[model samples]
Target chain A: GAGVSQSPRYKVAKRGQDVALRCDPISGHVSLFWYQQALGQGPEFLTYFQNEAQLDKSGLPSDRFFAERPEGSVSTLKIQRTQQEDSAVYLCASSLSFTGGPLEQYFGPGTRLTVT
Target chain B: QQPVQSPQAVILREGEDAVINCSSSKALYSVHWYRQKHGEAPVFLMILLKGGEQKGHDKISASFNEKKQQSSLYLTASQLSCSGTYFCGTEMDSSYKLIFGSGTRLLVRP
Candidate 1:
């Protein structure tokens, strides 16, 4: 795809189940970011990756949340023991660079995860 | 703190104008504007880096006031295609993370 691509556009998982969301950012983009958006709310930062390195994970809601980008191309966000509160739209975005104060970020369609 | 967007929603007639404002309680580094339709990803519209600088696309323009920690988006001579939810994303000190506002839904009536 020409733009950012995400897998499993919609997922419904039972409580205590595990789920993984995948994101394929724009090719050659160096910066990737994950955000979680609850119903009727704006997206909140969850993690950030600069190339293959996980620069920051401070925004992860809990230990159950994990993300990895092994080769600076595709990234995955895994959530274990899902809870009702875990339901939200997971969004992935990528920018051309990270050093500048602000870079235009291209966003994916986002994966809607519903934990029931 | 999350930026506050005023006029939670607005309704406009074709060829009209609308203004959406976003304000932050804390200092800000930059402001980004994006528009999202009913069920799609937010698309980048414009970015304001310097205070008092205004950038425009067609009839859409935006201004940033560094001292007030606020930014406003102006849509002049609006068209039907302009109807959508507008969100203001802010960054502090150029942090990698962008905090987006709740959003303001705009409805354009023909």
Candidate 2:
């Protein structure tokens, strides 16, 4: 009955370091999403997963961003060789339906990644 | 493309009403609204579908004008609890992914 959960609530990484963020969606949730929130701005979509297969990833900023949902429940978003611009809050969300009116998402507290 | 939200920020007193608007250049299939307080997760507020179906609590309702590619979230008799940054996520296609707007910051004081 827990909502979406992300590990490493806070992270400090040096520029050019690689960081991996984890997300555990609600039990049996079919849809999962990743977003990046910069200071004073809204969240920007990074990627989406339906079960273990990632259907859309066009929102990923660059090649440094990679995500996988191997088991269809737990997902990991890896940022390779991070940059100072990568400093932001990474939020994970889950929803019940894939499309239409009930597309409400349940979000986690988010992992704040500070790149120095 | 990302949607656009108006009134970058607003300050209101308790019991007042506020409206947040989201407009998109592309034809939208649905619009979703959410609220996020400082240092907190974004909570779902409501969803407006293409064909006139709307979902939300009575106090917080949203309307979608399909023809104009716009949606408005109306918060009547606002409460301090309503103080937060409001975001509108737009779905242009059948995919579940949402392209979120820049967001509208709303502050309510007692």
Instruction: For each candidate, report its DockQ versus the true two-chain complex.
Output: 0.77, 0.75
Off by over 4 Å in 2: A99-102, B54-56
| Candidate with maximal DockQ | 1
Across B1-110, the per-residue lDDT of candidate 1 in tens digits comes to: 89999889999999999999999998888899999886688899999985678899898999999889999999999999999999999988777678899999999999
- Candidate 1 chain B weakest lDDT stretch, 10 residues: B90-99
Error (Å) of candidate 2 at residue B11 is: 0.9
Q: Which candidate leads in lDDT?
A: 1
True contacts kept of each: 0.68, 0.80
lDDT of 2: 0.91
lDDT per residue, candidate 2, B1-95, as tens digits? Answer: 88999988999999999989999999998898999999999998877888765556868988898888999999999999889999999988778
* Candidate 2 chain A TM-score vs. reference chain A: 0.95
